[model samples]
Target chain A: MENVILRDVGLRDGLQLVKAIVPTEHKIEWCRRVVAAGVPEVEITSLVPAKIAPQFADAEEVVAATLSIPGYLPSALIPNARGAERGFALGIPKLNYVLSASEEHNLANIRRSTQASIDDFGRIVELRNETAPKTCLAAGIATAFGCTIQGEVPEARVYEIAAELCGLGADEIIVADTVGYANPAQVKRILTGVMKEIGDRPLLLHLHDTRGLGLANMAAALEVGVRAFDASIGGLGGCPFAPGASGNINLEDAAFLAEATGFATGIDIEALVALRQTVETWLPGERFAGQVAQSGLPKTFAPIHRQAA
Target chain B: MENVILRDVGLRDGLQLVKAIVPTEHKIEWCRRVVAAGVPEVEITSLVPAKIAPQFADAEEVVAATLSIPGYLPSALIPNARGAERGFALGIPKLNYVLSASEEHNLANIRRSTQASIDDFGRIVELRNETAPKTCLAAGIATAFGCTIQGEVPEARVYEIAAELCGLGADEIIVADTVGYANPAQVKRILTGVMKEIGDRPLLLHLHDTRGLGLANMAAALEVGVRAFDASIGGLGGCPFAPGASGNINLEDAAFLAEATGFATGIDIEALVALRQTVETWLPGERFAGQVAQSGLPKTFAPIHRQAA
Candidate 1:
């Protein structure tokens, strides 16, 4: 394990954005490729209703197939207590629960009020503690920076939510720029404030490249001591709720950034680059954006994992 | 004027890579529109031979037309002493002279050794001092980070060259990732070393978005107190000499990053966004890469110039 973690959310986040339903076997293969590329963790699929997101109708099968793969942590996005129950029943080791920081976004996304979601989140935590003590529960604060529906989300509200989630037994907390509305200054400010409010807790960041600040925001967060980030392979995933948001920061690019900035990610970038070809073939005509894919790795770049091996 | 400088190099750098030769009138209009967008500086053209870079055939005419526009400092790329003489004769205010930090890149780029380029740079400085005292001589250290030809460039060589330029009475020193081979760690490391060696001199940065670290590299440079950056409108310009290189960082996105990070760029982002349309029309079929153009400015984004006004 390296000091930094790149949690690949391509299957859950990436697939949900695409209309075409990728075969469950291909989703399983995607997991295997990323893990073989030395990614330690992956959010394999989301336990959402099949009707709501038809692309992820085979989430259960994906989780089952991915869990059989060795040497990688397979996780899933649990939208509510029901999803959490399903994941627990399936014996998944990690469940990422998301709640929007803005009330409007929460209402629009999950059709629930902010307080109602928090109450449900607490129930999910309790269920996790009772049913699967070994499972890690991560609370993701979506739209933590700003929301398209509500415009500017106050940093105070984000900090308060972070404090609340920390108190509510979230083993990990993630600050997300859901609509890609964050800049480096805002990222540094929010990360610093939330870290001050909840001392020494494991914090992760999920940034969208909607306005091209994804890697720059990552650099700012790294400057402020953030070591974990959520990324989607081939830069997949966009906010269907947000009007003009782009996609998640490219995982291979994010891993390349981390490693290039001297943070050991244990990711094999060449393998990730190769996997991108398969992804391209799987989703024909879908545009994938990343620089390493076009320019290849710098000659000076040496993967720490390869060196160790 | 704002605290940060977004010197648009689109006309010079952007058009140079483009195969189509845009009319001189359109090039002049590009300069005027960018200036109206509140950019403080623009590199309007390059004084290179017409046979070598036919796209810049009207360099002198473009400079003559753009210098008539007020508010923005009009500059040009001066490849050698002859080009410097032409720019000075045209009364272009700033002449950006390129010299590669790697000997291999210098020989390949300009058919001269690194030491010869330095000597030519000194001659250009002397020529400006004796003939046109008002013309600012800027020494651009290309491949300051790494080179496609030589692979990894030693930081000491960059520092040595930067210090030499400062000593030789160059008005400005620019560290360029000519092939876009830089990561943030290398950026911070190189910038710190050069700044320490050449204390308190005006240092600018020219970053290529070749591998998509352009904005990220810009943020790293900004974190270490670098304020001036070279950007191309619509992410234009790839090195005709270097293989596998992309374009300069996009000016609109660069301005967006600067303003969002609380640095006052004085750039009217909306105006710039509109100008991108004109650029697209001017260079039809050319692919321009930037996020701000794809996703309009965030709701909370307030242009610093608009705020000050």
Candidate 2:
């Protein structure tokens, strides 16, 4: 867990939520700061039709900027094989292939059924192998906990899809609670079973605080040996897939939790709070999320664990 | 758990964080609104020195006003036996007792050692038995998780103090993550052990999202069958006890999580959100917390568990 990598997705996921369109160059600058921070990985942009998400119109440019930053793992989201192809062509570090587990969510979010999306995932895997062998392919099964279109996603279905994603040659399999309905016990229960089937695929926990269980679910996953987590800087990206849900785990809060406890994720809390100042200036209309950043550290704060030892 | 009482400490615990003194009448009016919203229990005020917290200088008067509200189980903080006497005379339904678990925290917060505080608890218990027989007494083992002053508070000591409190005739024990240093696993491990020693005395979880594990802790406590919780509206209070930590668990977020995870806390999410508007007008500078308040409910948001039974 000490080696866990927290990828800051504020540039892509954070920017995606703003109603006001950020300039492509400003988006590039967002990528620059995150890359400069030397976070092990970053989801720099989400590739979609420009009209739906104007904030991410310059996905190509954002990926290109990330490509320029060495030692930073640049990644982007692709909705289909086309998005996957575009991402692979960039010579970036990773491509996140996302699909909603609920059939209702897939139809509403991507205008495809669950199986259709799974079929497309096969193309994505093939695209990665043919076009970008070095580019890591991670499948994010969104709404793994439950969905807005269809509530209470079965644990067996999530486990089955994870196994299939692994069989399809996914470099990593991420179990996401898109609507944030998972409790820690439920997270522990599901992940305990899911890990058995997924074997050794680097399982990622993509959690939302939609129902205030983001960090709890993450903790349960960590207890079961999950070290890879996907979070948004300033808890940006309320939701591209679900309307009323989008804020990922706030990077600063997660860092504080991880560092305060016995785990290590090399996130500087004060620096992360500083990063939110930039985000505040960029996304003025959008309300930033997190408690530690707002309330500040405890007066008698003791950092029991060392970082990057 | 649906029948379990949730005590809102927004007025007493929440308001002290903001330095700006809200007018006494306005604070009183908000207390009325809180009670009208169907909250069964509320920690309306604390009997600390007025000089230290002028915001709560009217705690006695506030308790008087709170007791007037029909069916309100009004509670107040008494640092020692004297504060309990004041609350007892007022005929309030509950008297909350506090003693810090960390030796340094006890000194800094209440100017007492662990043994001395325990001795005081015995005296307070005796006083309650002699005078305030009608008042429900709850002893809070503050900083049971960890402390800013002494750092890691031992689990054995926490369990011992909980048993001691129960033996001293405390009606219920409040386990607080004062510094927000507790994670989900720790919350579960500690609360489970404490419950065993204390028999059936109800355990109330008082959490702060300071380090973003408050809700995570709640989920863990839920696993251990400790149903009741303490939250403040807009996550009020800035660790006046510990200093520089996050506020209490925002009531709206806690209610949202409780309902989302198939548990009913009997809080109206929309009503809770509406309640924050009143606070915004009063304490504008104070950073009130909660994510669900901003995001609203998921489109697929259905309280299936709440409806089924």
Candidate 3:
């Protein structure tokens, strides 16, 4: 059976929009529980300053706590060169850097032009090589599908940016439907092109459920042979820059989709749902989305590994 | 551009689970508004006895009211030969008949064995031939993916049922994921096989959003060349027999997905969202689903027809 990697980004992305700060201990526990549920990777925190997103104030504590969990690939989202330097100082195993394909969104999100962000990404790669050669750099193209501020982001621009990032020695390329404006056909069309440009490098899709096509988009990517995704538990997290958008595709639901469609995720869905419930209690009044948590797993469901056995 | 027919099943399937009976005048207005929004067909009501489903008590009135709308195809669900006779007597344009592929689900839902329902469907076809030759008979195989009561519904069994229904003179065949147990892979596999069996006959997919794979499953069907679907306004219905299932795919969202993916649905999404707001007020305290309603249409969104122009 083919295997897919689902990286839980709930701690960083999910908590970004919330008003209350989730305790650092709870964030660490969240990491521990999800890894126990067989998620191979977790984006434990973002490397931005507390003034920008106060919810991520305890990034160091959260990242440090995650390192103790054996066999877990802990990662952090680093927005700029300064953030990358901070992540490098902590010896983070993986650092995710994002630049929007929409120039308007890039400027709004990080106060930098798309070209400037691309140049900064190259500098971050150099910094990683010099200070922390072991750290992995994943360059994410945000608003790669479409943009709220600037409508109709051209698909050709996405391919060009992906090729440029690959040339800059990035370890991985992540295409994000940052505002959830993608359809399955667009996903198939764009991801197929991006894959061609970044030959042999790992490709991951960071999708949002804004318009209810998240899983459909993921399914389309799967058909094009994308086996890595970034999801959040309970479908937490939305882009602060994109108004009226929902959160990432629910991690439990994404895992369920992978297993149901003949791909192995190695995730225990029940455990994820249980973790979601705990998280819900921890942050009361926050909106949570996903179906498996409400209906529970179908009686016919079985993990891909078990089905093969 | 590829064209898809989105049949609004909101009046029949969407209202099936509601405890409060919606007035007949409101139902007529719903028919008028949705047709004005460019939906080609609608399942206006079910012909079951009023005592069993008080929500559909005014089936004849609803069906009659829908027929006056220009270019609109009005249909009703006919559970048995008696229901078909009621539909035939009213001169309904189309009648949808369903039998579960899972015997347990068929027994629980319609209180008949699967074979008994099949025999009854054959009788309904003969009745339509004799009494109402112009009326279309659509045979739907429910629980074609999996069953809540009986897990692991075999794919071979579904193909057999579709072929049998086709042989029995079914004018159209519909494959329903009654409990939302379908993944995109299963949808592609099953719909592909069913399409082969019912060559050149019109096929429709009846999908549910019970597990958040509704749109994803629909995308897979679209890839397999199945262009027709059954969706509900605001996702208002669920199977009374399937305990934890949510509702059918939202009509507005389904239309948006079709338009976004280069398939012409001819639906004005703004109009549907407006109607959804009115419907939500009508049925106070009912759970409504779909992201398009919550987030509104994206700035990049364009109807397929407009995009072509």
Global lDDT scores for all candidate models: 0.88, 0.77, 0.91
lDDT of 3 by residue, A1-309 (tens): 888999999998999898679999999899999999999899999998889899988888887888889877999999999999999999889999999999999999989899999999999999888999999999999999999999999999999999999999899999999998998989999999999999999999999998889999999999999999999999999989998778999999999999999898889999999999999998898989999999889899888773231
In model 2 chain A, the worst 10-residue window by lDDT is: A300-309
List candidate 3 segments past 4 Å from native: A306-309, B306-309
Off by over 4 Å in 2: A19-38, A49-54, A149-160, A189-197, A295-309, B1-4, B19-38, B49-52, B57-61, B68-72, B112-114, B150-160, B299-309
Clash-forming residue pairs, model 1: none
Candidate number achieving the greatest lDDT relative to the actual structure: 3
Candidate whose TM-score is highest:
3
**Residue-wise C-alpha lDDT for candidate 1, range A226-306, written one tens digit per residue:** 988999888888877777878899998898898888788888888998999899999987768888888888877876653
True contacts kept of each: 0.75, 0.58, 0.83
- Estimate the lDDT of model 2: 0.77
TM-score, per-candidate, Cα-based: 0.97, 0.87, 0.98
Q: What is the lDDT of residue B52 in candidate 3?
A: 90
Pick by TM-score: 1 or 2, better one: 1
lDDT of 2 at B204: 87
Tell how far residue B273 is off in model 2, in angstroms.
3.1
Write the number of the candidate with greater lDDT, choosing between 1 and 2: 1
How far in Å is the alpha carbon of B228 misplaced in model 3? Answer: 0.3
- Cα lDDT, model 2, residue A19: 76
DockQ of 1: 0.81
